[model samples]
Target: MGGGLPSDARTMVVYFDGNYVDANDAKVSVFDHGLLYGDGIFEGIRIYGGNVFRLDEHLARLELSARALMLAIPQSRAELAAAVCETCRRNNLQDGYIRLVVTRGVGDLGLAPWSCANPTTFIIASKISLYPQEFYDNGLSIVTVPTRRIAPDALPPTIKSLNYLNNILAKIEAKQAGALEAIMLNAQGHIAECTADNVFIVHQGEIITPASSSGALKGITRGTIFDVARDIGVPIREADLTRYDVWCSDECFLTGTGAEVIPVVKLDGRVIGSGKPGPITARVLAGFRQRVLVEGTRI
Candidate 1:
């Protein structure tokens, strides 16, 4: 456990292991398998209007990630959900972000996970830093990075694991390219997703995004957009996309827990759509905001 920190130095409450502790006191062992070998799972959740949006869906995804990694979470789904809500309440968080992490506890310096006896779990709830207002207003410009997404056979993108070096590398490329984000392709050079968000394009009033088989994460926000599109009678589908498709699309955007819905005005220096957020993008974004405010588990 973390020690020797000023009691009032922390402004947020963190659920460290099984105890509610100060933010400064939230620490995990250096020998944790999650740190040593990236043997862990995590989820990024959002709070809107004092409600934890899609809590059940996020917990379900976390469970799936644990199952995929063969990692056993110490807490049950119901218990974990309660912990998330409790953490938000303890921090007096009305609208913010929550990062829930479960790591294979402290173990010897080895890759084998069985050596770890207990699992380390924690929850952090704090204010979220959204994309700049200008980015939302003028839109984001992105480049296609050289870092291809990991093949599903090697590491399925569905699992939100702690091993994110793949994404970090692409993010670096984005920064170096003077863009806000980078779009990653699959092993076969098919459009996959962005460094952190799921990618989507609208062509001729139809919405299309890369299929899960194309190495895209099953993003909760992406799913929400699908639902919103259905409710609004906008056609949507999943398919293997390419740079050409993006270049020719009428509009482009990204979705994620953090990014939410942001339009892509440029890709690889080519302007997307009319070089701005499209009508459909605006409608879906509005619907998403409306849905989050009313359709979630109240904190």
Candidate 2:
């Protein structure tokens, strides 16, 4: 999905290394530790009606990841916020996607972070569509790939690190299997999450998802669903869920910054519920839509 962003986006201004520059000219060194060793972190945020949805939460999550990697950001959070808003404003965009990347700066071919003294930061605000419109209209068909999620102890899922070979492999498996997304399971066979989103299932009229301990990323959109469910009086909980639970559940859905809230109709050829977007799924999405425009940091 290209997202069908207008041509104007190609010429959009961007923030790169403490300076605003044309997207075409914004560049990073080939020796950057981020490119060489995947030593960095990032955040994907969305702007709705000039409202940077959950900007604070996204930054907080970015901070957590940076802290985990011991990567010191060049600018303060406030400065970063201003830069993000300015990038959007300069592009004359009312709604778009934002990518904030902080790398460990340029360093030789070595495995030491201390070798890189300066970190690189860049921001790009643009458009994105994770799936086709028809998919949203009908629903998505996903699969459970053989590729299991990395053990939490081995690599904390909480850190939004630059390395994504694990997720990329799972995505390849899903595409090969004719699926739009892949559901990853932990080493213990517990449902962890989708390749890029957090998953949830409705069981006996209650919403449930895998616990944080199951290697699920603490997604911002995933958290917003809790508020949406609560506002609509839909009970929700987190537990150690398995494939059997998802198959038997009444409904299923996934949440993420790019995916937002999307319904899941079929899993590995098995129809979920009635093979349609469930009522609760629709309501939750509607609730999410209501919050996006009104609750956020105005650009």
The lDDT of each candidate is: 0.92, 0.92
| Least accurate 10 contiguous residues by lDDT in model 2 | 1-10
| Model 2 CA lDDT for position 173 | 99
Which stretches in model 2 have alpha-carbon errors above 4 Å?
1-9
lDDT at 280, model 2: 96
RMSD of each: 2.4, 2.6
Clashes of each: 0, 0
Residues 1-299, candidate 2: write the lDDT tens digits: 53543575568788998888987778789999999989999999999999999998999899999999989998889999999999999888789899999999998888998999899999999899999988887999999999999998988999999988899999999999999899999999999999999999998889998877899999999999999999999999999998888888789999999999999998888889989999999999999999999988998
Displacement of residue 110 (Cα, Å) in model 2 is: 0.5
lDDT of 1 by residue, 1-299 (tens): 74564544368789988899977778889999998888999999999989899999999999999999888999999999999999999988899899999999999997888899999999988866558889888889999999999999999999899999999999999999998799999989999899999999999999999988999999999999999999999999999999999988999989999999999889998998899889999999999999998877898
Q: Model 1, poorest ten-residue lDDT window?
A: 1-10
